[model samples]
Target: MRYVREFKGFAGIRLESDDIGTADDPSIILLHGFGQTRKIWEDVAVGLEQAGRHVINVDLRGHGGSDWPSDARYDFDAYVEDLRAVLGQMRTRPVVVAAMHSGWIATAALAEDAATLASGLILVDPQSESGAQSVRACAEELSASVGQGLAKPDYDERLLDIFDVDGSGARLLDSAPHINIPVLVVRGALGSGHRAENSTGYADAFPNAEAINVDGGGLLVNAERTEAFNGLLIDFLERKQPRFIPEYRSGSDARTLRDAMGCFATGITIITAHDADGKPIGLTANSFTSVSLDPPLLLVCIANNAGSAETLRSAQSFAVNVLQIGQQPVSNLFAGKGEDRFAGTRWEVGEYGAPILPSSLGIFECTRNALHEAGDHFLLVGKVEKASFEPRRDPLLYFRGKYRRLHFT
Candidate 1:
């Protein structure tokens, strides 16, 4: 269950938050980064609640549902004080989870008395310091993550002008030693560049802290590697701030098992072929691999209940279109229901008479070689008749049930 709750922040500002789960359960306060709202934590909140934690997903002073100050006081101190006030208003000391820029606020808020204000702290893709260039890069990333055409931007625009990113980093480093609580720092691919050394130093400043770097994960770790992040979060919570001990029996939870399997990352592909009537049929799939090189063989596992499964299984020829980063919409269209996937996409017939996406990173036109039933899915093996690829493009990636892009850091 989720309810809207309001809290008093610095100077009596109304901070809006989604109060989820039972109040009796241990509480978790979620804070999003700059240019992002509490909506980012919607999925993470549900996951935390399911793992027996009460979640309070909140909006900062000038973002989302929270009150935007008339005077435009978007400085670092204002944010820190707002968080401190929110903690003071809470009935229970909750484990505070902050991401990116908000991590600095959370750190400063709990610096003086972390034990009294919060149980534990978790920072996602945090940076201890930032310069003007870093701030601009963050804004650019936020725009790219949604789309280049986002017209109405979230949060008060004054924030960018008012907050001193360069000074905030140095102040956060000064405050880190004062915060002596259990801390977990999660770094993504973005952490490898300008913030790598500084983030490591920040995490080490904590008296009791551990850090984990996620490979191929972007700055938005919770959004990209959600399942993996949740797993790490819950595990950290259980170990550091245990309320009740729970043991998991093997094969007990299907969700747990599925989440475990999601850790193994794979590249996205679209399996395309024509039906008996010569109509194009395709579906998005990540269950693909190169089987052998001697005879040039490959295989893709299709679920038995898929709409195109039967057609693909008996098709004399088929094509695997390895998607690039720009083809996420195409992947979603093929994976969805009641859509003319081919009509919306630009594709052409391959040399082997199989439909192929013209803009794909790679294309494998093949003829049916073998088929094998494997539980709920069947493996369709094919002899590669022709293979074409574009070396300049980066392949689309999938991990932890979310679309990913190759991030070279």
Candidate 2:
């Protein structure tokens, strides 16, 4: 739990995360639901860090570890003012805003001025109370609930305490169409307040935005089905991951490898397997190419990572799960750091004893067809296993080191 430096003019809890990377990295500021604190985001922070993003999950005013103002004026402007202060200390313009419940209130307050403050907005299932009467009644109920908790002071259970079933409504959801930032609304499958069309309404309002519905779990979804939620979040971020041309490359300076790869756009794949010692391992490569129509066979080139590569060379059996567009984060997870990436990801073993993510464009449970030496990586061929794919949603295509979302404008 990090303390946020106070804004002299504002009076509220300044909860912060120590996501101290470079000052310029895009940041996510999470606002907890009403009656909750920043602690609810612990697992989320871990997932975001693994995906290489800084996250700040904070306790709003009148909640855990934050200061409650003596002023009874509980209007949202005051909350927005508090956010302004937090954003002031935060780096650069166009920050990302993620809000749930009461945090949605703060997000809406800022959406009217998004170009001035944020690049994107993510609103979790929010309260959507419409009329002034509903707002007044909801405000009274909200005040009493927080007052009761404040009177006691032993409210240590942040999740159970804050998420005690207030349910969502329009009282909290601003006229979403008025929100100007690119928005991503996340709803739990159960106990969610915002209806499906409600999100669509918000999406329609914003010219450059989309909405996603998750089924793994409600308001308690993210922590419940961490893997599915993580996968979905990862997929979303990868599709949204900024495409930037880096200034320098280590080996070849002239044409650059990325530029060369750009010439012949290819499919990217991250292959994984256990070593002879039965330890999990994986690596990333863009050399995954389709080869054949009648039999349906695919190929992957694996670098000499301690992971399944060695085992593949020896066992000659593995599963190839072709990733759809925006699955780059999962690929990175399998390719990059951490000893427990599999634990957080959902997968099932194929008949051949290889693990594969449940949803993939192609699933190849094959005996090692052949292996050949490549430059530094090995070409491991796999025959088709039980394959499945969601038609219309295209697989991600890469070339010259850029990921493009295939959609007709």
Highest TM-score: give the candidate number: 1
lDDT (C-alpha) at residue 283 in model 2: 58
Pick the lDDT winner. Answer: 1
- Residue 133 of model 2, lDDT score: 26
lDDT of 1 by residue, 1-409 (tens): 8899999999999999999999988899999877778877777788798777999999998888899999999888899999999999888899999988888889989999999999999988786563424544665575556322336557887787777687777778788888888999887622323344434555887888888766555544535566767778899998887766444468598776666677799999999999999999999999899999999999999999999999988999999999999999999999999989999899998888889999999999999999999988999999999998999998889988888777642
Candidate 1 residue pairs in backbone clash: none
The reply for model 2, stretches above 4 Å from the true place, is: 1-22, 131-175, 189-198, 216-224, 241-250, 253-409
Off by over 4 Å in 1: 130-136, 146-151, 189-199, 217-224, 246-409
lDDT of 1 at 345: 93
* Alpha carbon RMSD to native, model 1: 9.4
Q: After superposition, how far is residue 323 of candidate 1 from its true place, in Å?
A: 35
lDDT of each: 0.84, 0.56
The worst-scoring run of ten residues by lDDT in candidate 2 lies at 154-163
